[model samples]
Target: MNLKVAMTRSSSPANGLLFALTSAGLYGFNIVYARIASFTGASGSAIVVYRVLLMLVLVGLVAAILRSSLAMEREERGKLLLVGVSSALQGIGYLSSVAFIPVTVAAVVFYTYPIIIVLVSPFVEKTPLTQALVAIVAVATLGVCLVVGPAFSDLDWRGLALAFGASIATAVQFFAAARCTRTGVVAKVFWIQLIILPTAILVSLATGQLAPPSILALAPFAVTMTIAGYVGGFVLQFLALGRISAVAAGILYCAEPVVAAVSSALILNETLAPLQIAGGALVLAAIVANVLLEQRRRLKDAALVPIAD
Candidate 1:
């Protein structure tokens, strides 16, 4: 029985990594889906409004069906609400960036969130910074620069700014979520969608960007985004965070841009410059190195813990 229990414990983190990778793939598809919706005349804010509304209804209904309590302590509610606001900002900023820049560039910029998290870890996560981690982050940053640097001169400044904003907002959202008290994944996501829905609605209305698409255009994409992106991607992401360290999850999420770039090339007829290709390779290498180093560190730490007989 003890051996069985130990095996279960050892398997969970691996499962969490699998969940994170699955979420990253779905998120990559979400980028493609968003671009398709944009081609079909859906504005960024309009897409956010639609997607958040759909997620709210779906998650809420599932929670109700499960008889899950949506209640949280007042302090936890406030933190989760802040996380929701950040998520909304990330959605708007990232989608708007894609509106003005190539998907690859926008994705690379948005991926800076992992670096941001690492940089701020000492303050927010209270984790010690090691030279090795810093070096890995630097390589990732260099990789991103290589990928997007050439296009930087041609892209709109507004798009760059929005992408950067999205990166910061995403970093904050993840950190905040990590700090929050334990809550059901569905309930947490439901509350986040609840906060995002009204904000998205107001933004779409205020900006006069709320033009509804044809049912033919809206139906397929809406269902796809709601199921694959929100339910499959983000719900799994939250679940993974419960099992793995936030830093591990963030590093794994670096897979997203690579997936997006490949998907864009295949689906959207996008091509990367040779330099960009090299940069992407570097980014993938850095993410792999980070993951391996983190695993090693975890093993070392575990070895140091005294086993009780």
Candidate 2:
């Protein structure tokens, strides 16, 4: 029994890594689809509204079919609501960035959220500054500067700003969601989508940007977004986290930008400047280093903990 349990534990992280990679692929493809939808005249706000609504309806139906309860405690509901709002902001900012910049550049910029989270942790969680963190920050900053060097002349300033904003919002969403107790993944997603629906709707209405897409265009986009991007991607990430340490999951997530970059090049004929490619490599290295350091810290903490009697 002990050997069997050990084997299972060892295999779980491998499975988790696979799931995380799958999630990254889905998300990368979603970026491409989002760009296409936007080019077809679907505003970011409108796309978000539709995406969340479709996911909510579809996930809710799955829950109903499984006879699963969608109820949540009051605190969970509040946290999920905040997560949903942050996610909506992330979606709007990222999609807007894609409209004005190449998908690969936008993805590289957005992936800087890991570093952003570390920088803001002092204020948000009272984490102390460490030399390792400082070094990682320096490296990441250099990477970002390289990546954005051409943005000043070649890319729209608004797009650059939006990409950074999306990164920050994504960090916030991840942090907020981390605090919540585990719940049914589908149910949790359904609730988040439920909260996002009204927020997106109100934003679209208030801005008078709620230009609905043609049914022909929207039907396919909605199905793809709901099934492949939102549901499949999120579900896989959730499952992966259950089996692997978050540090390992973060490392797997680093593949997302690469996948996006390659897909954009093949599908959209987008090419990155040599400097930008180098910058992307540096950024990815910093992220990988950060995750490794975090994993080490976690192991050290675990070792220091006293075993229960």
Candidate 3:
């Protein structure tokens, strides 16, 4: 069966929402595993390097089986390179942040990308930025303040900074993706990972952090779970982006941090302060409100279109 047939039911919003939720959930779990990879002995840079290497191999195999070329035209290579660089940066940022803070904290900070996308979309995509959108971004920013402020004493400054940086890189990747032609989603992913793999290796080499990953007090290869999760989450992510608008997919990603919080509590025994939880709630509420308003806006715009006779 085609990968698209398995991942998407159709191009409808509901299908997109399903793909978004599933992709986010996988990513949420991957964050926990990445932290575990750290505890088990893998450095953040090492983890990203290995994950990218493995993902590129697997995605390359898939592309080969599908008879898809992994090469980009010279015209498209610039955007592909940008997307790849942003992906590498985002991966390093998120994994590195987990080394210094609780996985849940990293998640909360990184997920600010949804709001970032909305704020920047007008400039990048020519979407109108209405006053209501401004108000929503304000509310979400306040919520982010609440969420991160209460945990300031416990969170490492480096981790918080890294997580926020990841958010920016993620937004850049999404915008770049929006401009890309939609053909060969899997091929696009393979090429993107190919671009990232070398960058990861070079960074690891320069920092002298280029050790092979090993887990302590477990099966030697257990850390491969982190790499596996990275592979799966990325495959699902590109599929989701192919089927849905970036903003819609981003709004649905409100579930990711929630998934991270809950999983960290259950698996890692990490819990948030009451105030931080409330702030996270406010951020999600703002996202939910945006979802509703966007739906209404789309409906209104649809009604205005002339019906074909």
Please give each candidate's TM-score: 0.86, 0.73, 0.78
Who is ahead in TM-score, 1 or 2? 1
Q: Candidate 3 lDDT, tens digit per residue, 1-309? A: 454553233235555456667887877677677667667567667777767776777777887788887666667678777888899888778867877997657766887887888878877877887778767766666666565543444778999999999999998887776566654677788789788888788878987888854422242343566667667777777766655566666666666665666677778898777876887787678767766776686667555654543
**Residue pairs with backbone atoms closer than 3 Å in model 2 (clashes):** none
Regions more than 4 Å wrong, model 3? 1-10, 73-75, 94-112, 135-150, 153-164, 213-222, 304-309
- Model 2, runs deviating above 4 Å: 1-25, 94-112, 126-128, 137-149, 153-165, 206-213, 216-227, 237-255, 305-309
Q: In terms of TM-score, which candidate is strongest?
A: 1
In order, what lDDT does every prediction score?
0.75, 0.68, 0.71
lDDT of 1 by residue, 1-309 (tens): 355665565566767777887898888777777667666566667666666767777877887799887776567887898889998899889877877887657777887888888888888878888888878777777776676543545888888899999999998887778766477787788888888888788778877887674432654754466346756888888777666666767777877766667777888888877876887798788777876886686667656655544
Q: Could you tell me which 10 consecutive residues in candidate 2 have the lowest summed lDDT?
A: 243-252
What TM-score quantifies how close candidate 2 is to the native fold?
0.73
Ranking by TM-score: 1, 3, 2
Candidate 1's error at 67, in angstroms? Answer: 2.6
Q: Is candidate 1 or candidate 3 better by lDDT?
A: 1
